[model samples]
Target: MRWVFLVLIVLNALYFVWEQQQPSVHVQQLPSVLNPAGVANIEVANATNSQTKTLDSVQAKINLTLLLGGFSDPALIDSLSQRLLSLDIDVKEVVVEEVDGVDYWVYMPPLVSRSVAVRQLKELKARQIQAYLINQGDMQNGISLSMLDTMDMAKDLVQKLANLGYTAEIKEVERKQKTYWLAVNSRSERLIDESLMTELTSDFPLMRYRQEMPQ
Candidate 1:
């Protein structure tokens, strides 16, 4: 009985060794979750990179202010500002007064009363002579003939008034000149467009411009 039991045990051990050397028949597949998760993460990272590039592109465009100036004529400045407004551009107008030089004012001495000044003004106008009555200041009730740049020009005007049977004198005064400017703000290339520049230069020969960056 003991011999038979030993033979049986030896046979069972040999069977276990044979099973360990054989290939598996009932194989189970993995869920493939890790590969899909990795792919999803990579896609999210790519999308984030794309968004960063888009933001960089937007940030690269600069907003600038263009200063258009060198204009002396008020009428021309008005025309230019209106033209720019029509193009849908943002524009701000600024008028600057500067001391140009001295001027000579040709006028008559103060009259006795406001009534006399008004009568003289009407008479001058009726005679086709342009004159203004000074209603205020030290020259109140006086007659203004013209504003001249030099004493010689004032004397000429005085002589002309004398020939018209009126007395005139000259006084020196400071001259103030006005300059017009436009500040245009935009983020596009419209400020430096060739055709627009050509149009502006053609219309206003003295129109000039410069650029100012934002802070």
Candidate 2:
């Protein structure tokens, strides 16, 4: 009976040693793959950044300008504006002062009196020389011989008048003309393609244009 009890105690001690040698079963916590709060914040931030980029791109496109110029006639400018309006294109009118050409005026200086001017005008008419009596301004009581396009023509007329025993002077006058332009946004430039340009030219045969940046 004593030997049986000793054998039981030995079996218990061996079982304890075996349990100590076995590997530990520890439980580790893992990260969640579908965290609602974290996912919502990240998605909202990405969407906001994308939307801001798109708005900036559109703003850059809107700031550019296009200019179409060289329209001389007011009536033609009006028609073109109406045509652009019909096509839903925004346009603004711009006028630029340009020097068209020079004109030379041949005339006689103001005479001593109005009676003297009239007498000289009559003498010119009797001699078959066209003349105009100056009625007002600084040249009052003077006689205008003619307005010639070229300086050479004016000098020739002055020599002819001198041969006829008449004094004539030449005055240079600058001829200014107003040029009309249609200002459009760069975004609208795509709408004015070759076909549209051809149609516009057919409608306005005298319309000449050049493109430039906005001032």
Candidate 3:
């Protein structure tokens, strides 16, 4: 009986030593908050901050203001304002005025000419053809010619008018005291014997005709 007990104790000791030498298997627990389909919240926050910084830098480069006047269309004003703002410009003011029976929009920065503005208004009006005279003092009038130089321009205009069934002639050319005067003879085939000379004279107020002595 004593010998059988010793052999059983030795077998138990060997099993315990084998179990301690064997490699153990471990199962890892995954985080419950992780989702494969969705983007991480931290990554989204970083991207938003980067985009905002880029927009702010782009806005700093542009600096121009415009003041619009005489334009009453809220839709037009809003569209124009938004477009300019998108380009990072500032609109300072807008004013509308009615002077001498004509509506006028005075715009600051003056991107457009008075004639162009008048034409736009007329198109909006959708009736009678509107004539506009731009105030030369308000804007730069580019490259004007003297009377001698104007004669060349006038000659071209007169020739073109003559080709379109109108009778026109440069009746006299006088170089007096270092100045030249051109007498223009104008008659219209369409309005025969019906004070065409008077009409021409009124149309060209700056021109003077040569007087003819009676024979």
List TM-score per model, in order: 0.37, 0.55, 0.23
Candidate order by lDDT, decreasing, is 2, 1, 3
Candidate 1 has which clashing residue pairs, if any?
none
Clashing pairs in 2: none
Clashes of each: 0, 0, 5
Give one digit per residue, the lDDT tens place, for model 3 in 76-184.
Answer: 4455445434544444333323332221222112226656555444542353322233345643321111222344665764565456433333322333222122211
Q: Which stretches of candidate 2 lie over 4 Å from their true place?
A: 1-66, 95-97, 185-206, 210-215
Q: Which wins on lDDT, candidate 2 or candidate 3?
A: 2
Best by lDDT: 2
lDDT of 2 at 34: 71
Roughly what TM-score does model 1 have, to 2 decimal places? 0.37
What are the per-residue Cα lDDT tens digits for candidate 2 across 40-158? 99999999999999999887656656655568887778888899879988889889888999999999999999999999999999999999999999999999999999999999999
Per-residue error (Å), model 1, residue 166: 0.9
Which lDDT value does model 1 have at 156? 86
- For model 3, what is the error of residue 17's alpha carbon versus the real structure, in angstroms, after optimal superposition? 1.8
Please list the Cα RMSD from the true structure of every candidate, rounded to 1 decimal place: 18.7, 16.5, 28.0
lDDT of 1 by residue, 20-49 (tens): 999989979988567887899999999999
